[model samples]
Target chain A: MKRVPLSPLRAILARQLRLLRAERGWSQERLAAEAGLNRTYLSAVERSEQNISIDNLYRIAQALDVSAARLLTDL
Target chain B: MKRVPLSPLRAILARQLRLLRAERGWSQERLAAEAGLNRTYLSAVERSEQNISIDNLYRIAQALDVSAARLLTDL
Candidate 1:
């Protein structure tokens, strides 16, 4: 499969997600389970291969106990 | 003018921007200038009418002195 290039926004989001998850010392699987998301989907998002919905973002943010704005501040 | 309905993501972004700005007691104009963005554009983003780029978001986050990950955690 051809790897699609991520847009600047997607790349930023991917980096931010990884950083946030790391800061919390949570593995991807734990974060995904806490956020009520699939591990594979979370992995895809972190890799910038998926376009996630706002609801999903909200769920993830809630799981992380942070505001959505913080997640978006970087783009 | 007909006000277009905001997507869930847009609404979340707008709310977060407003909340963060208020927390710092910075007006839209000051935030815009500090972030190197136009006041009108910042206003539009706060209203959820503008689709901002990742670069712009990074600038805003820098101006606000917050990590990009915090802004995205609530995604």
Candidate 2:
């Protein structure tokens, strides 16, 4: 298989997620429950360890009361 | 495995990709090549059959000469 290149975007997204969650004072568990996601999975996403799907991104954004695109902007 | 809910955003993204490629008059093979992805995989994404990861989304957006967030906006 051809290897995928390293992407700075993932780290950027991870930082954005953590920042957003911190701004709301919500723990990973709270955000995960609100987004109907597993807390562990959400933690992985926040750490940029998961190559997150768009559906999950949408769910997380909804739970955070933000646009899906907003999570990815300015990065 | 736990079930993941269906999300309309995937369909929206698929439609956006198709529309963008059409606007450029590029075939799936062409777009796939430009995005450094397999043609069949890219086709699945266009059909909303794949829950595409953000890294691939970034690659596709780069290949299309648009912002990564642009692909998810106005949907």
| Index of the highest-TM-score prediction | 2
- Report candidate 2's interface RMSD in Å: 3.5
State the lDDT of candidate 2 residue by residue for B1-75, as single tens digits. 235577667777888898899999999999998889999999999888988999999889988998777788754
Per-prediction CA RMSD (Å): 9.3, 2.4
Which ten residues in a row are the worst by lDDT in model 1 chain A?
A1-10
Q: Which candidate number would show the highest DockQ if scored against the true structure?
A: 2
What TM-score results for chain B when candidate 2 is compared with the true chain B? 0.88
The CA lDDT at B9 in model 1 is 58
- lDDT of each residue in A12-71, candidate 2, tens digit only: 778889989999999998999989899999998888889898888988888888887788
- Per-residue error for A26 in candidate 2, Å, reads 0.5
lDDT of 1 at A63: 78
